[model samples]
Target: MIRFCSRTKLVANLIPPSISISLEQRHQSIATIAKMSDSKILIYLMRRDLRVADNPVLHSLIHNKDHGFTHLLPLYVFAAQQIEVSGFIPEDGGKSPYPEARSQIGSFWRCGPHRAKFLAQSVWDLKDGFEKIGSGLSIRVGMVDEVVKGLIESFEEPAGSKVSAVWMTSEEGVEEKREERSTKNICDKAGVDFKLWQDEKYFIDDRDLPFEDPKDLSDIYTTYRKSVEPLREAPRPALPKPEKNSLPPFPTDVPPQHSPFVIPTKYEEIEAALLKLINAQPLAKNPPKCPENALSVHPFTGGESHAQERLEHLITSGSITGYKSSRNGLMGTDFSTKLSAYLALGSITSRQIHASMSVFEDGSASDDRYKDLKGYGKGENEGTYAVRFELLWRDYMRLCTRKFGPQLFRLGGFKAEENAHLKWSRLDSPKDGFSKEQIQEIVERFLNGTTGMGFIDASQREIYHTGYTSNRARQNVASFLSKHLYIDWRVGAEWYECMLVDYDVSSNWGNWQYVAGVGNDPRGNDRIFNPVKQAFDYDPKAEYVLAWVDELRGVDELGQIFQAWTINDEERKEELGIADTDMVKNPLKRIDFKVNRGRGGGVGGGRGGGRGRPPYRPHSGDRWTGRRPSSQDQGRGGWYGGRGDRGYQTRGYQGRGYRGRGDRGREMRTGMMDKERDATADNE
Candidate 1:
């Protein structure tokens, strides 16, 4: 299935008028294009790769040896069935921690609110990006293979024109691979060509892997990393946007609703429109913005421009140097490069990041102020090696999926037979002590961030609220779910698949299986993480715990606060010297931390300089202003239509800044806690 291709240069030929007339009845060709010269049309089937920059498929399309295409129709299919019916598994009755199943046209839909919102924003930004290059994306809502077939059937090649091939970037998931095969089958039946390029989402291109066969990739990450690090073959450089002449304008006359080609402006209108099209909802609004001072928060905005800016900021600000040490920080954007979401969506290519890193490493000046962490073996560049190191880890996960195929999605993963004895059978009776009801209750509490363990709750609350958390937080919470509660790892994996804004199939499931002791953990079935010790080690001052878990804000001995749920409110207020207040559910609230009047209490109790650390502002100016569509008007093709060059301005968090579900947090800060700071941090 490896397809390495260059553009075909064959001369365009006209299909007979007889065939053209028959095709016309099914698919109406663009009026303007129908009358134009006999140049053919090329459909760019946009999938994960949403950007115009560094797109190999688009590049090959335009550079076809014949230079044959005069029309490049960019399309995106909202695969409703794929999201609802394929990857998701509903709870057994009321036994799962996540939401109950909701049917959309007889099938269950699994995409959550936050991911839906982020995806909408990313697609909108993508449309804007394409328009700048003098083209429009014809967004369709349906299964990809069927949509492509319909488009091909309707295509009336001009009197002497032919349809060039349909092109798309390859995907790593088994389902995506199946869809690709299906798409090619449809194309074969229709007598049209289908082409694919290796998706360069990872730093090491699959075609350029050091191993001769994918099966040769190590089962362990370290072994794989050691084998590849020495080759030092820099990723292929990114290509710039194609010339405007090569991009023909999209048809503006496509019917609305079922096949509308424009980005919906508001969350509700878009939600409603998408629901009507496929009987599914995209209801989540943008998440709330973290305070400007919260350096550790991702402050994520979807799209390629934002991805580039974040990468630049990391390099120029010298944050890349300490990346190895700070990458695991449990909170905030500065702890690690917040590029995963961008990478996951294909907004930015891994080659672009690696290329940029190489240049930065070569040009960066050394500083004597910071000490290098021991054992932080980086790339040739002293401090940046860890960034590449992480990219290699991402590469290995993708390779793992490729090697193991669909089995990666199963409960036992690749080692099903080997781990058979460790699998626990389901138990339903409450009288048995380990009943499903009890386990479900525990899962519910974990999902709601009420597990009574401060470290675990804060991490869960972060993901439940923000659709994100640090890798450390994920591991800790996952350990609690699998090792402590002994729930099926698939449940947590599926929950994460629905919730995480940066969800990637291979990485998410692979990591979950690893922790659950069902996947490729050579360490065998002994994956245990102590929440208390983890809290003490990662958050000794309990600043992170207090930031997300408001109830523990006034507790003096932070160590004891992990189990604060065991204490009655009146007892806690008296013991911890805080006001008696209702439990806060939202993390965006403004909680007032009053100093203990007599004994002394307020954040670290004067042990770590009172308020602890000053707010960490990573960027000099605002980062969220440029990407939001100007109006929420429905049926308007001009929301981003007339912005001109300013459309791509690099200002205030480029693209629509993620504002968590747009529900304002309850304002709880008052009196002595008047000094309000941004709530922040996530490290993964």
Candidate 2:
């Protein structure tokens, strides 16, 4: 029921030939090990934590026996299919990816295209990970408890060795508790020994939790921070590659499809579907560079090998040094530790990374130590603690998610004040004298750099082409969307969730509430962004503006056409494509102020600007470099998302770029608009 673990080291050892061969066919030494008391099978029921390294359940099995091969019957059951098989794309377009399910307003709720694509891809990647290490993933469909029970029964039919034990791991929150209990029941019915390893905190164990139970958690983040600070470092993490030999044939029938290891399939499809959807929408123009292997959209590669690859790369390449300075920026790939998704998915446990960070702190966190560590490249003095602080923050969000359940899924609670504003925007005609078309008119104005709100216009383009923006821009945009555009905050949250590559459910929903004056801003800081002044301070030279805004291109003094659509004019010039010169010049500038163009008018009787988008630039050197390249590739894009999510990457921005599914949109931008502009620097 309980076991003390000094370490979760995974050691590799081969079983003696005597165990498999008859007594007459084996060497004396083989019999000695086979008869030795230590040989056993540890049934480590794999959960979200799929990696073989630093797996405590595996370590426990290894430590208990002295001579036997440490063979753990690791099992994973595929269950999402049970839920998805009932799939019918809703007529209202309740979902995405399939023929139905498309919602411009918070369509995010339905488990549609984005989710389907990602899940399928993740499952495949997970299977591959296991095979690479010489193990097989036994995927079983049906009730999880029943399937696991059958596995133990089958394993016991053989030697009944250590496989007789059911070694379980501790989990947090209600859902996890429920799942944990179900696992225990399976082991109980099978008369197997179930051991639960403790991982109380992300890196620290349960004994180290400052408090127990959700109620014990301090409501204030600062309080939790101060109390949890100066915590002990993680235990040394170690895992040997699994031995080459297979476990003895047990009575249990292992799931055929479940691989030894796999990241869920939700990632890739989500990435592709997202891209396809976005390109088709009026919002997107060109194709984007997609996520590589990109199938899972997890910067975390999902399996042990991929996780280590990133960790080693992180420390050796010196990406960890300038972290403090670049993390908050809105555009570029290296701006932040994109590993959060992997951590959440359980591809790479936080403890392993924590251990790796300590090694990094000594080497890269300080200059003197850097010189000592070789390729240390200046642990470069100071701010390593800041990185540590981020880890702590991640811990905090997890705590919050645990403490608050479906509440984290709510929307109307915090933004009540904006409720009225939301209502008016939907009206056919605003009592304030704007037409029902006002919202779209305003949205169009903002996108076209004609809103007269410089900041709003700049930010719109941020999402328009590059498909990203800074936290500052996000806050500004949300406020502008709510306070200025009078659009619902839910609409904005959905768009952000759909676009941001770094989108974290907790952080995204949490921040949206805070900004909309609903979640945690107790001070009620629901403020507005002065679009023009912000442009002066953040995008003053019009360089950022020049990168996105169609009309401002080539206008040496941007103010010359700051409000290009202000005066009555028709037949004005329009630059409708993404050319190096056009990106630098005119794409949309003329304003047709006439209520209705004089008799015999078409398209409202004005330059293309007044009637439609500035000019659908296939490649303005931002979102995409060209069209879908072909219809066969038409998938949606989200975050560095499923089948669809990837950032705006011109040929110039290719190196740190996402590997598009090589399909339509080459993984074009879709649901999650890849809005964290500061995450990746564009090629231009």
Candidate 3:
């Protein structure tokens, strides 16, 4: 993390023009030294911190002009093999056939089509930015270590300049750490220096924290929050782009002039080179586009220019003024700040956003329109503080990665003393009375969004289509899978890694652990969400559910649609477009009573106190037909409230409705009590 200028200040000042040789002689001497030792070549190994402005590592080199570096090589390596992971290997020492199968599958790529598209866009954007400053980016597709070594060796030390140093921003995950160590080893062997600096992408520095040592920081978020909230440091100002003329002048001897910073590789032709790498795989019948456009209200474009434009809109459009109130919304473009996708890819930076917030706060406090709006409880600074508070959570996750290291990746996260008594399952093999066959069947259904739970199905479908979902939807789906379904949390985490465009290693894993009762939640309680209640509460009109769930959208009864699996053949065909003979005969799998009520007794004994009830086990062939109540028993109230034919109006859902529900809607109401009874029996 050392700055070049700070380290060499004395040496630079001592070599003033008054005491040195003539300017012409000095230039010749520097040129001779540069050719002799190849000391001017600095390789900037661009990783997560991809932007030019406010990028600490890049800024450090550009600022310390007297460090004798005249040429810079900006390099990015696309190492696809790094993402491969074994899906589920048993921990109890039993032999499994999965290891051999995984080996055969060569590419279990976690970065899916959507994220791949976003990544290509970002790399192209970065190359454009470099071109503006008389430089170009070198993109290679291979193992980072091997490619870097080849790049260093290709530099002929006698005739051309060799690499003097390699520079990159410090990273946090286990794989990133391994890459960093490999880079250091490569530099050591090549006799080149390796410099790593902490990237301020998460907005805070460890030096600003009150703790003497970062490891001493608590796993509990509240403790960490309380210690730093009032004492938070103001973010550093973002740096300006280097002047065009400041770049090394072009060589004039050649017929066509060229910038000194250009690299010798064929990557100089960026359009052709980048396109080859992006489309390395054979094209499908249909080509993939950016995922955000399909599922999100506001489509996110990848680039620093777009990032800056979005930030300005948030401030000037008064979106920042009301962020606190609208952040939890599930449907709209303005529901939450859509900056996360850009932040994950480092297209935009936290420092730049923080600086923008400061300006917005100062300006808006005096404006008449903003002054009249209700302050978010912390006086006039609530909106700004709220945004900062969220940023702190992002920082906490990153610091936790440093403090806990590889433990964050483990299934039993942090291994809190309170969780010692629990005996958890891997769900890949039989354990705790659940058979392997049943587990696999259920998990497959859940992943495919065919578990027959309306709310869960909709959320999963949205994520599959968009590569993005609201935080609320994420919590509900995660809770349902880990708590109610009782499957391996890692599978869900990995699935998210494969799907989410904004997936961050630290944030995604850390959040999964928190929801699964395996991470830093002080209560040691996993969050259990009741999908029915959540759907009713968040999407009161069932608009979100209707949008993603096609089956429910076609159903005629607004009130009875929640229990659509119970409908008789004749009514099902008339209400929905399906034929009477084609109606699914089996009952929907019963969503456990405890799950419907949102009871908590997740892996680590939750809010219900002691270890509570064992996991629920439904009867054999727990199909939708068997689970539904018979005609005689269906004369009671509906699942949530009321009986048949509840009048409905579409407020925000583009105005769609049902014409009829038939007599079967009343019959389905009688079974609500029976469902509650089944819940009691499961607890026993």
Candidate 4:
């Protein structure tokens, strides 16, 4: 197979203030490229996604071997261009001023010293990965296309090889579109073969598509499944180690920067000054590492290696098996997959995830493997299609961006339209430019979660402090804040976008619509959260509330769980207008996995639907729905409390145990979050 990589030698060491090569300058300078070899090479640059296995473009390149090709390279270029201009600031700027939603920008790929160190570490590890295979990188600078073109010119002719083809896949905005097109156009004019792959993430892949087009597809989810049932998926192919002797040489310098030194150095000096100032003046002993919070955790490495470590930990320890049952407890890491943060960066790919699930499911039917097949419907379905669906959902968001173009990000909130009228956040108080009292009220509680509403207050505090909240808690808190408290959901969603480690841009926006009454199932009315009821049902023992909100700890894990909803009789009249006699008691629920260990029992869930619906508008059927029975609907609901006990209150749960890792009453055995990343969670 033909191979190509960026020429590190071509990268300039220049920093910003120098003008980047213009398209004309690039064309003029790369004119020598037209004379290169008989066949051409197209090397797709990889960003955070560095794994070879399950790479579709790589598969296509391998498949094209018989077609007289010299090399198929997945090239990665290093230059200032990769730097997020908006993310970096001069020393005098006093550290990054980005809002929380955009905080990842600061440390993404290691923003400054910490990020630079992490990138150096990851790149160093990558160098090892390449060395193992005998291939080095072609690091280059300047315009991406210019550097790429220069390499094509320089490598082809002397090697008696023609650079006849190119292939690539991308996830980006307007500028990326132009670059891809320009490169393709140049290759075409040069008589080179060029191909661009389409990404079909979201609901399903194209081959598995229920119909030929979006309009022809099933209107409902059920119909969509039935139509695609005939076409089953084979386990996606895995990549073998690359042939080392075939690797290209490692380049040293990258392109020079050209943007007015990017940021002023003075800002850096100011930030250092501020760090010292803040630390000295703050009443608290330790000032925040970040002006806001600790953004640099060892838990913050971005790359495939880290992804693997997390996956290994989850599966080997059987955490995946318990994901369903305890995901909602809100107590600690054991309650959720901390994959999202790494996922937010392009560090890991979805296919890498699917293949790992395969390893976990392998076994003969006669062994314990047969038992693992319980909830799988004994159908021998390879993996939990539910997890697959969510992964695909991530793809769908990526797909939406490409398919819809800039319009996808242009609209505001759930409704594919502007929504400036809603009072968004307290920070947007009279200062930055908001005057509405309703807006101010939400801003008040959200800034620090001191709201008297314990459940809401508890969740807001946890996320603000540690950047975490269970899916159940997130939905419930969001619903109460927007629907019940009369605040706009957009503000809350933005806050999450800033704080969530696993935050996927599309999913975050998509989920907000699902909960805030916009997007797909946009509900026109309110879907208020009943804090008291929600606390009792999800955190039933209220251990989660106690754990996050210290004052609430030791008071009562269960007895007064519905405290916000008049946990006692007196408050019902004040909060929900229920009579003292109307305060119905709900019992605590727990898993007895020994009795229902295998077969089909496990887990809870999240997201989706169009605009205008109540926040957290869950699908109609399935466990984990947790729909509290209204007076009229109470009689018809099924018993969720457990077998023979009828007062369960319709908490739609599929059922299973929490992966044992972070269980409180059990042994604590987790390695630190940072160390776990290096071994990486999504492993080979």
Give, for candidate 1, the lowest lDDT window spanning 10 residues.
638-647
The TM-score measured for candidate 1 stands at: 0.70
Candidate 3 per-residue C-alpha lDDT over 1-684 given as tens digits, one digit per residue, 9 for 90 to 100: 423243243333334565558766755554554444433577788878778777766666666777667577788765534321121112353432222111111112356545655666677788788778777677665457766787777663343456777888888887788788998899899898898877777666655676877688887766777776562354556677665545433221111101111222332243333233324542211222232223565367667777788877776666776776666567877766777767877777776777777655555344454343333223336555656666767777777877877766565665532332232334433234544444544555555565566667666667666667777677667666665555556667766765677777778877777766677764334234555445544554556666766655666443223334545556655666633311133312443222222354422212222223334322222212222334543453221111111012111111122111121111111111121110000000
Alpha carbon lDDT at 145, candidate 2: 64
Find the 10 residues in a row with the least total lDDT in model 4. 675-684
lDDT, ranked from best to worst: 1, 3, 2, 4
Clashes of each: 29, 116, 8, 101
- Model 2 stretches astray by more than 4 angstroms: 1-47, 66-105, 109-134, 139-206, 231-303, 364-382, 412-503, 527-684
Write one digit per residue (lDDT tens) for candidate 2, span 444-536.
344333444444555555553333465556766665554444444555665555444334555665566555555544433324343333343
- The Cα error of candidate 1 at residue 10, in Å, is 26
Answer with 1 or 2, whichever has the higher lDDT: 1
What are the lDDT scores of the predictions, listed in order? 0.57, 0.44, 0.55, 0.42
Clashing pairs in 3: 586-624, 586-625, 587-623, 587-624, 587-625, 588-624, 634-667, 636-670
TM-score pick, better of 1 and 2? 1
lDDT of 4 by residue, 1-684 (tens): 322233311221111223687655644443333222233454555544455434565455545556555444445543233322333334454543222112221111112232333343444444455556554443332346654675555554432345556666654444457667877777767666777665322234555543454445322323444454432253234444455554333322222333322322242432342233222332111211222232222254545576678776665565565564544456655545566654554445555565556545544223353344333223224224445544544544444444444442322432444342232222222211323342343344343554445566666666555556666667666655544443445455545654554555456655564444444332223333345445534554455565554543433324333333224444433454432211122111111111121333221111111122222222222111112335554343221111111111211212222111122111112111211111101111
Winning candidate number (lDDT): 1
Model 1: C-alpha RMSD to truth? 15.8
Error of 4 at 609 (Å): 36
